[model samples]
Target: MKAMRDVWGQALVDQGAKDPRIVVLDGDLANSTKVDKFAKAHPERFFQMGIAEQNMVGVAAGLASIGQVPWTSTFAVFLTHRAADQIRMLVAQTGANVKLAGSYSGLLIGAVGKTHLDVQDIAIMRAMPDMTVLAPGDNTELLAMMEWANAYDGPVYLRLARDPVPDIFGADYTFEVGKVRVLREGAGVALVTTGTQLSRVVEAADLLATAGLNPTLVHVPSIKPLDADGLRAAVGGHDLVVTVEEHSVLGGLGGLVAETLTATGPAARIERIGLADTWGESADNAYMLNKHGLSPERIRDRVLTVANQVLASHVG
Candidate 1:
């Protein structure tokens, strides 16, 4: 399995070399964000903006104004919160073609503590107009999203995890924006997931299948500008719909799927499995995930419980 850093860095290098207008701006974390690969290949197209995320955003906005596709790199916490004002005023307000690559999103930055963790970024960015938020589940999806964002015209935010996740899509898989991938198909229940949480969903689906229940698995990579039609179709007539995410349940994939299903007028029960609205300190990603009931076992239990509830509701 390829790491997210490899996919992100390689995509930047590939796109930067192809398009002369594509430029990279690093907030002194190019090495972590994996933009160093691009810097090495095309020095003139890469700019080091030190540790000032605000200045880096403004610089990217300026470059965007001049018809350059500026991809900014930094930790998710700093990129979304520390430079929020600049992102709002410059990128969202102006509708510039700026790409924001926020690496180490969620509690994936182990041992960095709450100060570095970015759990609220989805809620913040989703509220901003003209911002397309994306969280790829694995390396193949990340590569496809990077290609899409480079050609996409407008403000875009790509959230990537540092640690390697299991590969879900095949090498020949193609990704479309605002479209979800269904790995497993079932009728009793459906699992809607985004980011690294998808790996757990896959495992949970297997367990559910072994228990004589087939659970549908949906992978929603794009958080903002959700694919409501596709979601409704995938979840149509299902007894229960469960949303899983590695981020907060309030405004992440869980909330988005819930809203869409409700609007679609589905009588199916909606369940969310994700991080609560709380901060996390320095700890292992796996431990943090398990603490918040994000593990495959937790997901399986929740889905089974919801499935039971759905049957009860129907029987009544």
Candidate 2:
């Protein structure tokens, strides 16, 4: 089972208990998304928007207008694309206190096929004005993100991974919005990762450490309104930077980091380790991950290769 689903459900319940004004809106996927737990507790505040995701956003926006913090839950693809107009007009444009919970982001929604996988939600949401896009690296981060979103005053998009990901950040780790946390420090190569790929990066770091090579591991949970300064600091001492993520290399965290480096005048060698330019069909999660080069072994190999490149440059 997905640990993130349980963490999000618990967080929602906790938020609802603290604030009676908290409401949940589901698009006929309450049970699957784990928002049904909140609905069971607060039936009066929960709204079943049916399969109409567009109307779900509208309902969330209206609820937000009335001092209610509404959470809209659905698969990432449907939530971002189906409700694009309502999100842009009612949520982003008006700056509503609505939280869009996009479950099963990237190809993690495997077995559901190409139509369900949402590799482009981040790129789409980040383009919206006044929208805060957050992708938690694990269950711990997801819970912390929920706490942050509840206290925040604007529209937010919370992308969730469906896999049973590793618990990276400890229970006591504090999550600050728009801040990147460096898991390791290294002078050779930096591995920047976000979302589900963070666990793989952690494994890669361990693999490199065992080989007498240290690779900096940076976790970026927030995508939009990113902490460019923090990313720069993490990448400063590294001879090369390698970005790893579950999403596509285009318009994702890797692309954002590249854009940041370009503007900040860091001309260091950079590599993007993410899904290549391709669409996926229906498949299991493991098969989908390996097909896209997102497996832990692949990440370890990529990091080692990048380290070798740095060594060669120094030797020459």
Candidate 3:
């Protein structure tokens, strides 16, 4: 298994070969962000914008105005927090055909701690009017999203985790923006997940099934422009909707699912499994995941607890 950024960088090079309108901009972290691959292959189309995150975003906006599909890559915290104002005013407001690649997102940055981790990026990016926020389940899905984003018009935010993840989608998997991937079929509880958290969610689904929870596993690849109907369809008939992610429970996948259910009035109760608007600390990936109740075992336990509760309520 390879990192999502690895697939993303190579995919950017592949897309560049086909689309001449594609341009890449890096925030002085090309090697770390993996955009260095694109810079080496297409130096003329690649722009090294130093460490000025805000200015780099501005430059991407300018390039987008001239019909170039500018892809800007940087650390997630820096790209979202450092350049939020520019992103809101320049890219989202104008609906520029720019794609923002936020690398090292969430608590997957191993020992980088909270200073570099981005836990609120999905919430911030999805809140934008024109931004299409995506968190691919694995590297293969990441490649699909990159190709789709290349052909897609307007602003997009690609949330990439730095950790290696298991392949959940098969070779025949096709990416549809705002669509969910049904990983497993069943009906009792729905395990809706995004990004690298999918690995744990899938494991949790199995554990839940062994415990007789009978979960329906679903992957939400597109958080923003989320498939409301698709989510409803996958989550329909389930007693509980458990949204999992490496982000905050407030405004990421959990919030988006809640909003959709509210708009449609689904009778499922949501138990958000993620950091509760808290910052991460310097620790090993497994330690951090366990600390935040994101481990597969923890998720499995949570699902069993919630599923039992719903079942007991029916019995009562």
Q: Give the TM-score of candidate 2.
A: 0.95
Query: How does model 3 score by TM-score?
Result: 0.97
lDDT of 3 by residue, 175-237 (tens): 999888888988878888898899988888888778877788888888888778888888888
- Top candidate (TM-score): 3
lDDT of 1 by residue, 115-181 (tens): 8998888888988998999988888888888888888889999998887789988889887888877
Q: What is the TM-score of each candidate against the true structure?
A: 0.96, 0.95, 0.97
In every candidate, how many clashes are there?
Answer: 0, 0, 0
lDDT of each: 0.86, 0.85, 0.89
> Which residue runs does candidate 3 get wrong by more than 4 Å?
none
Whole-structure CA lDDT of model 3: 0.89
- Residue 23, candidate 2: C-alpha displacement in angstroms: 0.6
Cα deviation of 231, candidate 2, in Å: 0.9
Worst 10 residues of 3 by lDDT: 261-270
